[model samples]
Target: MYKILEKEDIAPGEKLYVLDAPDIARKAKPGQFVIIIIDEKGERIPLTIADFNREKGTITIIVQEVGKSTMQLGNIKKGEGILNVVGPLGIPTHIEKYGTVVCVGGGVGIACIYPIARGMKEAGNRVISILGARTKDFIFWEDKIKTVSDEFYITTDDGSSGKKGFVSDQLKDIIDNKEKIDLVMTIGPAIMMKVVSETTRPFNIKTVVSLNSIMVDGTGMCGSCRVEVDGKTKFACVDGPDFDAHKVNFNLLNDRQKVYLKEEKEAHKKCRLEERISGNK
Candidate 1:
């Protein structure tokens, strides 16, 4: 059992947990993820590693209560033990001194991008990070990300904080202003990443995106996290959660993401109902 060492609510519907997983923490790298099971009967779910403290033997994961499993995980308090925490899985992001690296993150993707940005900086790259959310309320870890970034920007659809625009818009402005960007890495909603990819494609800049695909098993055996890169099949679990953005088939990725939408909504609704009933009891 993996024990939760600390837990905090970072935003509405979002919770951050620091878990005591020394094995996973020691080997954890930026851009890898873990498959978590809340209990023996709980379904497996993938969450990107937000941060890790090897000395402390802890890893941090940020969870948004989007579906039943996440909501269940959110209710788990500090000191509680989870049934399974299998990983440091997936290919780690290739870190090198890529000159000027721009990191773009949206919503909960900001959590996933934090470690990567820090890694890039440590590797002697000038990291510029752009983070966005629907409104300011959804943004978290701004100070944490800012510390690792040489240049930092934030955007909100509602103009509640930072600039009133999209992260892609901010990125475009930077590119248009003749910034010598060596690489661009983005993680967020598929649509947001797709837009970022499109924004940089014309410049022939190297761009990478992290794919959040469905998975039953962390291994390649499940075939559930398959993605098409440059018209070739690749598994997100083993091959990568990161891929060359210019060669990725975003249309297919977006379509595949919707496959379980209805089921997810139903499950979320059921979970809420169960909570209400239990509260009344």
Candidate 2:
């Protein structure tokens, strides 16, 4: 069992957990993830390693309560023990001095991209970051991201923050201005990553994106997080949570993600009903 050292509600329906995971923290890297089991009967869920402090022996994960399991995880507070926290799983990002690298993130995906951008900067690259959310209130960690980014831009779909468009729009402006981006990395909803991939493909910029497919086991034994890249089958758990965006089959991934929609809705409903019933006591 891993103790939750601290918990904070970073945004609506989103929470950040600082866990006492010394082993994982020591080995954790940017672009890797951890599979968490809230309790004995809990479902295993994969979450990106948002940040890690070797000295503190803690790893931070940002979770958005989008499903039943996630909602349950969100209810866990500081000092509670997470039943199982397994990993620093998957390959870490390939960091190199790629001159100028642009890191793009959207919604809760910003948490996934934060460490990658920091890694890029630390590797002697000028990191330009772009983050977006549905509205101003949905965004978090802008200051933290900017501290590591050479240039940072934020956007909102409703013009509630930095810009009145998508992160792609800001990216296009940078590309059009001939900023000479050597590499582009993005993490977000599949659709958003697909758009970023498409945007950079024209310029033949090497683009890497993290795939959030349905995952059961973190060890790739379940085969639930399968995805197609470059016309071949790849598992997101063991093979990657990150892949060449230009090569991934986003349409299939997007469709595959919806396979559990009905079940998820039902489960979420059940959780809500249980919450209300428990509250009434």
Candidate No. with top lDDT: 1
Model 1 worst lDDT run, 10 consecutive residues: 272-281
lDDT against the true structure, per candidate, is 0.95, 0.93
lDDT of 1 at 82: 94
RMSD of 1: 1.2
lDDT of 2: 0.93
Per-candidate Cα RMSD to the true structure, in Å, reads 1.2, 1.1
- What would the per-residue lDDT of candidate 2 be over residues 171-238, giving only the tens digit for each residue? 99999998999999999999999999999999999999999999998787988899999999999988
Report, for all candidates in order, the number of backbone clashes: 0, 0
